[model samples]
Target: MTSPDVLDSYAPVVAEWYSANARDLPWRRAGTTPWGVLVSEVMLQQTPVVRVAPAWHEWLARWPTPAALAADQPGEAIRAWGRLGYPRRALRLHECAVAITERHGGVVPSVLDELLALPGVGTYTARAVAAFAYGQRHPVVDTNVRRVAARAVLGEPDAGPTTTAADLTLVESLLPLEPPLAALVSAALMELGAVVCVARTPRCGVCPLAERCRWLISGAPAPVGPTRRPQTYAGTDRQVRGKLLAVLRESHGPVAKDALDAVWGDQVQRERALAGLLEDGLVVTPAPGIYALP
Candidate 1:
């Protein structure tokens, strides 16, 4: 665990740096509603900001509120998602909107527990909306925040593969007492980790926490284990899934199963991918031989 002294020292510096350096993302702008922030968080799960920006704008324009989205068919959401990589997230967002409309009267809930109770809104996302959207004093820990904490506070080269209860506690200890200030600090820490204390190649020279960073003071040791390899996309089941989804998204109505089969040559692999999509609720079979996005 990081000492209280260290935690106190880190917050103001990072928050000040973020005030001057944070990206001009639309969701971060003032007056962005809770729904907009929620949409940005969901779209940013595995997709890059560059890709998510235009898509997010389009999605909000088409369905500006939870009620608007809930009224539309889920398939339209999937179609609008448009190569965001994880189609499941699109379905999850659709379901989330439906729940938000029905449960909260079309308003995005500000409380953490209420956000979590909504479909597809996990711990990280819930905290994010509560802090960023509502300006509550919660630790919004994501991969970036975790990595920043591990290196600056723990002297580790990087964070663990997944976030744990300990990670949340460690980050929460770093927040300021004031709710709005603490939210600013949380966003700052995330921004520092993302653009400065990045994985593989940290730009320590420009990092606000560089002078006090434990990893830097300790001579920046490398990670202990073998490095992880980048994920492959070609010829994988994910690739097959994308191909199948593309065919479905392009069509206005249900497509023939044979049309989907024509996408990939490996019939077995193709069939398995289609079945996975069906099971995931991203695809629906309206009839014996027809397939479509849902």
Candidate 2:
């Protein structure tokens, strides 16, 4: 059983550390709408802050509300995504906006289930929006938070590959009863993991919970087993997909199949990549052998 005292101890220190050290992200600022929070969470997936910030600013400025985005073409969203790597998120966000506009009357729903029902919204995103945007009490378990909990409470060097029901339960146990405080603590835990207690090299000296951390007490054992290698983008199908999409994004209308062929040399790999893009709905066939953004 998780101890209440141990969980309670994390609240004050995490909150204090966050107050002093948290990054001034636009979505975290006061008066940020639920729609803004929703966009940020989606964009942050597998993408870094340095790239997300400007794109986010331009996105919100162009489509400030669910209604605004819903009114635009999904192709526009894809075009505006602008080197964020995963273009599928653009399509999903556009669909989410349409859902919000139609179902929730242009407001981002506060209900967890409603948020989850939207296109591309999963468990983590649903909880994140509810906690961060609506000030609801929820256990927003991301990779960063899971790592923090693993090292600080479980005395483990890292969390497993994916979050589980057990992870949510542990996070719930650590949350404060008050919704606002719980939200702050949730954000603080994520921030702590992102900056101080990072995966590769943790800065234990600057960490607020270093003294109380169980992994630290256990001699900060090095990770066991083979480290997973980062996925390479160069010469991969993903690169071909990006190149194909870039052509469509820059073009005013449907691009000929021949135009796409010029972007990649290997016909087999290039065709596979373009087919994948079409399958993902990031590209659409406006006419025979002519591809355009959806």
Candidate 3:
């Protein structure tokens, strides 16, 4: 565990760096609501900021509030999801909106437990919304934040594959006593991880914490594991599913089974992908041979 003094020393440096270097993400804008923050967190999962920005703007323009989104069919949400990929997140957002509207009186809940209870809001997301949206003091640990913590505080090359209870405890311990300042530190740590302490190629030359970073002081050793290759998208089941969903999203009504078949050549793969989409509730068979977004 990093000593309290060292951890305390890290916050201001990282937070100052973030103040100057953080991206101008729309969700981080001064007047963005809790609903907007929640939406951004969901869209950012396994997706990049560039793709998410326009989609997020369009989504909020169409459905400004949870009540506004809840008033519409789930298909509209999926349709507006565009090519952001992982269309199920659209469904989950729709469900989350409905829950927020019905249970929380159309307001995004500020409580961490309440946020977690919403559809598709996991640990990272719950803490993110609580800290970023509500400005509550919560350790908002994501992949970037985890990596920063591992390398900077623990003197490791990288974090474990999954976040552990120890990770949360360590991060929480680093937070400042003030709720708002702690939130700022959390955001700063995340920003540093994203832009400076990135996984493949860290820009340590420009990092604010370089002098004090444990990994840098110890020679920044290479991670001891086989390098993982990026997954290919072409000709995969994921590609087929995206194609099928595209057809459905473009259509105002149910699409014929033949329409989906035209997108992918492999019948087995196409069928499997379509079946997976149906199972995931990203698509619905409104008629015997026609599929539509649900």
lDDT of 2 by residue, 131-182 (tens): 9999999999999999999999999999998999999999888888999999
Collision count of model 3: 0
Q: Which one wins by lDDT: 2 or 3?
A: 2
User: How close to the true structure is residue 76 of candidate 3, measured as C-alpha lDDT?
Assistant: 96
- TM-scores of all models? 0.97, 0.97, 0.97
Tens digits of per-residue lDDT for model 1, 1-294:
556887899999998899899999988988888899999999989688999999999999999999999999999999999988898888989999999998899999998899999888998999999999999999899999999999999999999988899999999999999999999999899889889998979999999999999999999999998878779989999999999999999999999988999999999999999999999999999899998877
Give candidate 3 regions above 4 Å deviation: none
What is the lDDT for 24 in model 1?
A: 98
lDDT of 3 by residue, 1-294 (tens): 567888889888888888888899899999999999999999999898999999999999989999999999999999999998888899999999999999999999999999999999999999999999988999998999999989989999999888889999989988888999999999999889888899999999999989998999999999998968778988889988888999999998998889998998889998899899989999999779988888
lDDT score, residue 12, model 2? Answer: 91
Residue 204, candidate 1: Cα error in Å is: 0.4
- After superposing candidate 2 on the true structure, give the runs of residues whose Cα lies further than 4 Å from its correct spot: none
Q: Any idea what lDDT model 1 has?
A: 0.92
> What is the Å distance of residue 24 in model 3 from its true position?
1.7
- Decoy 1 TM-score against native: 0.97
